[model samples]
Target chain A: MSGLLAVESAGALTTVQDRGRAGLAHLGVPRAGPLDRPAATLANRLVGNDPAAALLEVTWGGLALTSDTGVWIAVTGAPTPVEVAGAGRGSGRAEWLPAGGRLRLGTPVTGVRSYVAVAGGIDVEPVLGSRSTDTLAWVGPPRVQDGALLPVGAPHAPPAPLDTPRPPRPGALRVVPGPRADWFADGALDRLCAASYVVGEESNRVGLRLDGDPPERVRAEELPSEGMVLGAVQVPPGGQPVVLLADHPPTGGYPVLAVVHQDDLWQCAQLRPGDPVGFARLRGA
Target chain B: MDVLDLRAFGPAAVLAEVADSAAARSLAAYARAARVDAEEVVPGARTVLFDGVRDVDGLARRLADWTPDGGPERGPLVEVPVVYDGADLHDVAARWGTDVDGVVARHGEIEFVSAFCGFAPGFAYLAGLPEEHAVPRLDTPRGRVPAGSVGLAGSWCGVYPTASPGGWRLLGRTELTLWDPARYDPALLAPGTRVRFVPV
Candidate 1:
């Protein structure tokens, strides 16, 4: 049976997200999806939802919701406080909430974003084949707001067993040498890997802006706009590297020094402001 | 049919530099038609980026002998009606060494093709303008240019798909929705589509 949930108090930034819209970059559409794919997938699996099913991606939690019908749900990513109907309930495991029962998620003790997956998933209407709210282009459904009513699709898959928490690995993010590495001065890649960078406060879904020694460039002229891929580490005029994320622009004019490995992108998503980050080069695939 | 260079963008994608924008567009069109294993066949100023490449070696071989198919000829003619009332209308006319009416006449006479879409969703970079008509961008961009605001920069013309900061030289405004997520086709001006600006 279909279910409905009402948002009581939306968090600092909450939006519906799924696997994201693809094959539309040529049309200038950003690939808007869950920043943490593994966490989102785990949350969906715990609740017996499709891996690509839409869910609530809460940033810095404060989300409170009550379903009209009993539903199965799970919260994953950035271990946070989760309570069901006033009782403390742990996250990362499927839990049943009786009809009229509320689910509240408190601020994360550490991480930056969290995922909440319902059995049937967030059934908001899909745009461009995804329900993900693109914070940059303002594409897809509107952001979840206080008192907003969310539709839940009928459950499909069976719930899976709770697996061990897979926290983001610590240490340096891995990188592959660039499509535009020549634009930088000699030893630029070495310099980038040698120095530690702090996550800038201005970072968002578009990119993770960094505060560190700006990589010096040999090319001073403006580079004509070129296609940018996810994980592209583009160095703007300021010299600081900005790692392109899920909602980054499809094309950019700045030269890319390197690209972070896709597997390590989750760490970039979870990095909080002021967190230190280092890059490690991965050669010859 | 000559390929200038092929450089690895990352582990998966490659940027193939070609002769010109037309060649880049042709390559992108051919790749999409041939169902290349790449996820995105994106055309830029003078290069095409084949992203999410599944068979890098296979693609490399295909690109080695890639011949330019006359250029993209998909999609229908999209007429954009403009009011010719923009913040930089006079500035654009001044740069063109022409009066407001002359500028409108010159802009309306050309048939522009959607060379690429970037900067913002649904913002297609329309090409076909002669080199003599090239215009410069604003020294300082406006914080927000409303959606449907038509503008020109360098040798390209485009309409802002959504309200955002831009530095293009404004020429007019169109009422048509350049992008609509609710529609079956979100982007009104997909690449290769023919576009005409009508002065209303």
Candidate 2:
């Protein structure tokens, strides 16, 4: 009858996420929510939950859940081999789990994250019009810990046995040149469009630190600190690019080289460590 | 401030630059100029956001080509009570080659304006930290900076809305909650909101 599934095993970096808190960046709040927005939305729709309902965002894929009351739920994204009471969950799949039946999420197969949505939705106190967890500035609580009983609220409508799996990530990401695109040398734009960068080991929710050819700066003047956006790719002194993620800071000093298109944000979120990333030009229709 | 050219940020957002002493003043100007029909008008340390469902390109082009009415001289001053006791206070002064009083005076002299919001909710990027007062961030960032903590690094200053790990030197704390989600305006200080700090 409740909305939230109890946290039996809260894997690394698992947090409650929804559509994300926007329009508050002027107040210094970065939009922190599910890295894979489409997947979260799909999972929500499958369980007959609201589009903005909060679900568990499991990164590096390791989580387990059990319900106090029997509920219908669905698992999607990253092709995780989900098991409910010893049954497997595939892409675009829905299954019913009885009360106290264990729901487990194994390791990531294709992508790096997975979303598990309940029939109702997780009912946690929302901060700033959002139930999404922001760990960088303590805006929300840290990753869910073991033995934490999440309160599952009632669904807006009865559970639907519908199957709506998210579309697979596109092959390439369309990125727009940065506001400071002129800061780079003549060939910098070509290099950005030509090079294949890898997600470095030092990446996190705050930002994705990339490892690749260091681009030359055309205008190296010390820039005044300014506001940054989620998915803004800024290159530090070393020339490596740092892709700003959902939990990025309110402002930064580095020069932005490019910004990943909002549509491809899920692909950027699913990029595992050492994954190759090649930037493509964004063309308006 | 003169109206500059507009640039498209993304599918739903458009932005314009106001390369001035303080981005707050111009941001406020833009906010007032587009007062109506804007889904959201967000200002930051050095940028302003016009996000929503309208004609993003048309609005951006209009913003780039139109002149502003020079809105209120950006005069919403918020006096923050500080204790002047940050963990990195003493060291920051030394790096800037200034005495404690000198640092305090510089910190209070000019009114700081909200330029942008980014890292965390309610984290205001306060502009107007004098160039001389600016110092490089700590080599290794501090593990935690408490709520309402004032910090300075590089060319900007900021107040930690919540307890967060930061690299900026902390000089003091305040009782005022910069950000409380339950409130109508969660972040106490918003872009163009003047910040006037007074020692406790």
Candidate 3:
């Protein structure tokens, strides 16, 4: 049966997200999706939702909701204290929430984001074939707000067995030289790999502003704006590198020195402000 | 036909570096016409990015073999009615060594082509202004450039799809709705669409 979720507290920042709109960059649309793809996918799987189903992305946890129907739900991503009907429940497992049961998530202790997946997924109207909220372009569904009534779709299949293990900790991000690597000085990529950078406070879904020794540029002339891709490490005139994310603008003028491997980008979603990050060059790149 | 420098952009995409924005547009058109196996074929100032490729090697080989004869095929013409009363009209006149009337006449005469879209949704970078008449951006960007404000920066012409902070030299304004998400084709001036700024 279908259900409804009453938002009691929207937490720090919560938004609906799905796979996101693809192939629309020509019109300047950003591909806004869950930053932690694997975690979101696992949450969907645990709740028996389709991979393309829309779910909630909670930033720094603290989301509180009340379900109007008994449904299966799962929480993944950053480890947080999950409680249902005042009973503490473990994170990363499917849990039953009876009708009128209240679900609350405490602040995450380690990661920056958490994914909450219900059995049938969030039933918001899709825009451009996605439910993800693009902070850069402000596309897709609106951000979750307190006192909002969210419609839940009918259950598709029974909830998966509650035995999925949490994903292992990510290692150093792997990188390869980008198309505009020549714009930077010699050994710039090596220098980028050598230095340890911290996530800047201004970081958002658009990009991860990194604080570290800026990479020196060989070319002083303004580079014409070019198509930017996800995971691109674009170095601005200030020398600091900003790793473009899912909501990054379609094109940019700065030179890109390196690109983080797609498989490793999920680690960026969990990194909190001041989290130290390191990079490693791909073998033979 | 022009040879393009191809570079690998991450594992799933390829960036074809071209000489100029026109070449980038042409290459993007060529890729789309050839049905290149990619999720998105985006044209930029001097590059065409083929993203989400299933077979990167095969797509790269196909791109290498392409020899475009000329510019991209032009789309339908879009006539924009401009008021020619922007705040920077006198400033642009001083830069062009012409009077305000002269500037308006010259701008209305030229036929511009939508080269690509960026900076924001439905914001097309319209090209076609001659190199010598290129205009410089303002020393300081305005805090807010109203939606439909037609402006120029370095030879590239654009109309703000929505109210935003901009650095382009404002030439005039239009009433056309540049972006509407509910519309079938949200961007009124998509890439390759021919544009003409008719003085109102």
- Find the candidate with the highest lDDT and give its number: 3
Count of steric clashes across candidates, in order: 0, 18, 0
Model 3, CA-based lDDT: 0.90
lDDT of each: 0.89, 0.75, 0.90
Q: Estimate each model's TM-score.
A: 0.96, 0.87, 0.97
Q: Which stretches of candidate 3 lie over 4 Å from their true place?
A: B71-73
What does the lDDT read for residue B78 in candidate 3? 99
For candidate 3, report its TM-score: 0.97
The full ranking of all candidates by lDDT, starting with the best, is 3, 1, 2
TM-score for the A-chain in each candidate structure: 0.97, 0.94, 0.97
**What are the clashing pairs of model 3?**
none
Q: Model 2 over residues B41-97: C-alpha lDDT tens digits?
A: 666444555655377656655565454434444557899988888877788779778
How well is each residue in A231-261 modelled by candidate 2, as lDDT tens digits? 7889899899998888887567788878888
DockQ of the candidate models in sequence: 0.81, 0.50, 0.82
Candidate 2 Cα deviation (angstroms), residue A75: 0.3
Q: Comparing to the true complex, what docking class would candidate 1 get?
A: high
Scoring the B chain of model 3 against the true B chain gives a TM-score of 0.95
- Candidate 1's displacement at residue A41, Å, is 0.9
TM-score order, best first, reads: 3, 1, 2
